[model samples]
Target: MDDPVRAFLEANHGAIMTTLKKDGSPHVARVVIGLVEGKLWSSGTRKRVRTAHVRRDPRATLCVLSEDNPWAWLGLETTVTILEGPEAVDQNLALYRALAGEPEGLDEYRRAMTAEERLVYEFTIHKAYGMH
Candidate 1:
């Protein structure tokens, strides 16, 4: 990715993630996404339809919009890996911090994530395009 696109991704957290349904239709959701270790990351529970869709199909598209400029945006075509279980707790926390900074109640937040069975969706970019 170019520096400008990387910067745009790092600066924005709100994005639209599109996954494939079982019938090959599209499933889209608004997600809080961030750039971590050169990959795009998002946190979701296993129960969510979007999560299930990704679990079934690794291919996905992420559209990140500029909060300040309506015309500025970035679209990424990627392959996703779902990270869950005990190891995902810390990974999800890191993603949360990257997107929103330190939580006010770190321990409580961790507990909630564990209780909810949260997972991290890691995206590897294959193609990128858009106004950005």
Candidate 2:
């Protein structure tokens, strides 16, 4: 992603992500996104249907919108890679910090994430279009 696009995404955390279902229908959900390691990242759990969908189909799209202006948005065609286990926990923490800053009780947070079976959806931008 370019600097302007990255900055726009940073300023706008809320987006609607599209993933494909088993029948090839679109499943859209609101997600909080952030740039992590030069890629867009969102946290999910193993139990969620979205997780299953993404795992099954790596292709996805994210329409990131600006909270302040309805006219401003960015649409990203991306491919997702699921991260789990210890590496996922570390990446998830990095994502959390990137989006929301540092959290209190880091250890507790990690424990909770592990208990919840948290995973990270790492998005590689394939194409993008929108008004920055």
> Can you give the TM-score per candidate against the true fold?
0.95, 0.95
Q: Model 1, which residues run further than 4 Å from truth?
A: none
- The C-alpha lDDT values of all candidates are 0.89, 0.91
In the range 1-132, model 1's lDDT, one tens digit per residue, is 789888999878789999999999999999989887887889999899988888788999999998888998999999999989898889988887787789889999889999999999988889889997
In terms of lDDT, model 2 sits at 0.91
lDDT string, candidate 2, 2-66, tens digits? 88898898789999999999999999999999888677899999998899898899999999999
Runs in model 2 deviating more than 4 A are none
Best by lDDT: 2
Q: Which residue pairs come into collision in candidate 1?
A: none
Count residue pairs with overlapping backbones in model 1: 0
Question: Residue 63, candidate 2: how far off, in angstroms?
Answer: 0.5
lDDT of 1: 0.89
Question: What is the lDDT, from 0 to 100, of the residue 21 in candidate 2?
Answer: 99
